[model samples]
Target: MGEPVNREKPLRVGIIGCGKIVAQYLESFRRLQDVQLTAVADIDMERANAVAAEWNDGGAGEGGVRAVGVEELLAAPDVDLVLNLTIPAAHAEVALAAIAAGKAVYGEKPLAATTAEARRVLDAAREAGVVVGCAPDTVLGTGIQTARKAIDDGLIGAPVAATATMVTPGHERWHPNPDFYYLPGGGPLLDMGPYYVTALVTLLGPVVSVIGAASHTRAERVIGSGPREGERIPVEIDTHVTGVLVHESGVLSTLVMSFDAVATHSSNIEVHGPQGTLAVPDPNHFDGETRLFRLGGSEWETLPVSAGYVGSGRGYGIADLASTPEGQEPRAGGLLAFHALDVMESLLDSAHSGKSVAVTSRAERPSAVPLTSQEG
Candidate 1:
């Protein structure tokens, strides 16, 4: 690939959503020297104005980063990229719009609500000659990267299998706007499987086929927090999902994603080989402890952090994408995100059909992050 893009200049960015997750990206942008926040936009003018007012304080100069309508922001000549934090349903629409405007785009997880939509986004970017990046940049963090280093270094002889487990009572218990969690695009697997699937792809490789089964326990959920507290939302998708993925490299990964369960003591993910087993940290966060157990060892031993962007979080992917050469894929590029989404969607298809589903999309494993800190 071409040499990494120079980091001396900042990438001018415009954000397109102003929801709860926007706060995390805003916080990250403050510490990421390679990015410059220039504008904010949303369907709700009030929310857009509020976010612009809060983050633009003496930052963008002159008008100081005022809020604009989505169309205005998309057409802004000064904006080099669009940060799409909109809900899953709107992801592809916003991305296609930005690409049509000739701007690179980075978005929150699952890439799009469906692989067909995600494919369109990628195709549009290719036609527009703009880059596409997606989140759960959490994989670029030390947690998953360190575990990846162990497997790459032969701490695990030859990866044979893996298991990923995530369970919670439900997001309605805590999320302020929890209606989306019960929608078709918001089931447990689609909602949270991105992290686990992406981590597995990072550690193992792209999956080729999958078999799945799923269940839904409740028809409605009560909002337990925010303005919607005590509000009941209808559930339209499966709440619990299980699947087994066969990776291109022949490694098998068992997955469990649930919104109906009480809890799980299992490590977020565990990979096994002939010589050892590895306990990888949660893939939703940037840093954590990774432990390893050799076949003959009596107890698990914690492994030191050896790779990834140190002290990184949500928006690191944007910074990483900003520094990637024009023609190269970002470490958190859309291809990997598309692959993960395809895997999840296929799993759900298998669940409904009671048969194995083949994954038609694939992604090359992203380049490993060396031990490095953010340049500030």
Candidate 2:
């Protein structure tokens, strides 16, 4: 990459989805002076308007953000960037719209409903000469980044083996609309798997092959909390998934994700090398702390994570660009995001087909260099 360009102007951004995640995006955007969330859009006019009011005004008393449709948001001349927070199925359409409109794109996870769609988005972005970014920038945060640095620095001799586990009872227990979690594109492997898998790819490099098994443990899940009371929803996707990831460096990463099991121990991703072991913090934030444990040592040592990027709150790119100025290359752009998305697609296929799937694309590790904040 060329020497980082210093952005001298504010970035005018438009958000194209309105929901719970929007609040988190707003929180991150509000902290920055370099970006302005000038517009928002959603299918629901009322919800869109409500959310816009908040972003425009800063809250109930404040003159919140404004809302529009996908087309309007993309066509707006002031919009330097588009934050595509729509559902998985709508990712490709929104992304294409933004890129074709000559705006950069930052989308939510999975990149799209399927691998084919993700490829289309990448192709479009490449043709448009604009940047596109996908979700889970959390790995770029200090917690995971610091651990990755230590491992690369040989605090842990070349990583030989690793493991990550993420389990939850189910989203229907809390999510008001949990049906999507069990559909064609919805499964433990594709849903919560990104956070853990992306962390692995970023830390250990591209996976060479994956052997796996998957199943749906529960037919239905009842809501435990939320306004939707006593709702019994069918589980159409795999509730649990397990796999072995063989990295290019010969590191074997064993991973398991489930929506049926409640794990007792803390969820973790641990990489073991000849010298020691490093436990990465949750790969879902801009920064935090980590732990290091040597084989001879009896306990885990707390390692402070040195972070320079602020959590833009919600939008993968928004959180990354909260402190970034206009016209700067997005730190979480399409190239790396596409690699992560491709890896995820390969994992899901390996699980469903009971075959070892190889990653066709090798994305550079997720980086947070372009964005700057007070180092902590």
Candidate 3:
């Protein structure tokens, strides 16, 4: 592998899709000396103007990125990287456009609506020869890294099984536009399953087989928190999904995701081996501490939070990269996304066919690829 890239030249970034999340991206982008927040674009003109004003007034940088349409942002010469923070459905279109415009892309989770769309984007990026990165890059954070180190050092003898869960009360209760969550592309499996599945794939090898079951908890959900409050929303997608992932390394993984369940404990992902158990932190958030539970040990030992992907809420790692010298790379990239999508597809198919679905898509870890620009 080549040596990590130095953050000598600032990466000029243009953000597409101005929304509440833009604040987090803008906040983080302003802190990074190696990154210049160059521009902003959104379908909503009012939202674009508001975000542009905020960025220019110092929410992002002294002179913030220009608020423009998608085409203008893509055409902007100063934008070296395009941030695809658009809603999940629009991710592929914006990312494909950015790649076509010969700019690198950094996108939010799920990569795309389907495995086919994700593959198309991947092919386009390869054809364009520009970098394309995905979010929840928390796999490169201290929690996962420390656990990986311990496993490498034989702290956990050999991973045997894993159980991951991401359960919540659904998004229609919060997000203003919740219609997308019920569409064919939207579901708990495709929405929140990325983080749990990606983290598992990062730790374990590729999956070999999958059997899944899925169902809808409620036929309709009421909008709880927005202008559409008290409005009934029909649930067109599965609200609950469960799957069993068999890995190439002989490890088994049980995954459960739901939008209607009230989970008391945090979303826990545990890997069990002969020697010990490693409880990885939630990969959805950028930074946090993890714990290791040795077989003979009395308690779960706390792992230090050394990495600096620290920000409030979702953009901690992005913010840390924007502010610090740490040049971040996509830990949860296309491969992980593809694998998760494949797993979800298998689960849905298995549920429908009443049979175990074999997962054919397999990815070998790239020996020449480094997870991040920051190396120890």
Candidate 4:
């Protein structure tokens, strides 16, 4: 890959989605000196205009950021990269367009709705010589990273196995537009599995094969918020998914992702070896308590933070990508995202076939993050 030109300047970014999630990125951009938000776009012009108007006035300078059509934003000279926060189905389409325009791209999780689409995105970026980064960068933050440090330090000797569990009644109980959560591209596994799978990859290694089983709990769900309240949406995907991932390192990770359960008291994830077990915090958050219990210890002890971006949040991955050397993949790059997607998709496939599916994709464990603040 050719080195990106002008590495010293802050990356100029154009955003292509203005949904609820964009607000988190806007907040992060306000503090990250390595990225400059130059424009905003969305299929909903009103939403795009509102975000542009709200964020452009402050430190953006001069005429400020433009609220343009998606195509206009893609072609804008000021945009060095595209931050794609579009819905899952549109991820590959928008990313391919940005790559075609000769811009690096960072996107929200799953990379694309399917591994096939994700592969195309990665292939296109490789041919274009631009970088591709994906989310669930939450793995790069203190919560999961701290847990990773303990495991690497052998607090849990020769890691043997793990369990990751996430359960909730349903997003329809609160999400205004909960329909997408039930769509093919959405589901407990696809919607929430990225965070857990990415964290597992970060803490263990890449998954090689999976055995899975899944179930659908309901055909329709009622909206619980916004103007759509009381309305029902069809559920087209399995609501509860269970799987076992065989990591390349031979660690087995049992996974349970569900929208059918009311709650779960289990740790979001737990890694076990002969000597100890790690109680990892939620992969969805940037910071939380990580506890460890040795075999002979009286109780679990909270470990002090030892690694990763301190006080970081949603868009840290973009900033990390901006700081990465031109030809190198960012720590939260597409390869890892693709592998995580493959693992999830493979699990779903196994669920249908009642057989183990060998994952065709693998990612190098992303380099570890040393303890550091975002501005450090």
Query: Could you say which candidate leads in lDDT?
Result: 4
* Cα-based lDDT for every prediction: 0.91, 0.73, 0.73, 0.92
For model 2 the TM-score comes to 0.89
- Could you tell me the TM-score of candidate 1? 0.96
Model 2 residue 14 lDDT? Answer: 85
Ten-residue region with minimum lDDT total, candidate 4: 1-10
- Where model 3 places Cα greater than 4 Å from the true spot, the runs are 1-8, 59-62, 306-330, 364-376
TM-score of each: 0.96, 0.89, 0.87, 0.97
Candidate 1 ranges beyond 4 A from true positions: 1-8, 58-63
Per-residue lDDT of model 2, residues 1-376, tens digit only: 1112124555678888887778887776776556667888888888789887766564521244567877888889877778888877788888888878888778888788777888888787767666666777777666777777787678889999999988888887778887778876677777778778888887898777778888777788787767776888788777888888888779999988888787748547889999998888777665666788887899989876554354534553554554445454455656566666666667768877878888777666555343346222
Steric clashes per prediction: 0, 14, 5, 0
lDDT of candidate 3 at residue 127, scale 0 to 100: 74
For TM-score, candidate 1 versus 3, the one ahead is 1
lDDT minimum window of 10 residues, candidate 3: 367-376
Where model 2 places Cα greater than 4 Å from the true spot, the runs are 1-7, 59-64, 308-312, 319-331, 367-376
Q: What is the lDDT of residue 18 in candidate 3?
A: 85
Better model by lDDT, 3 or 4?
4
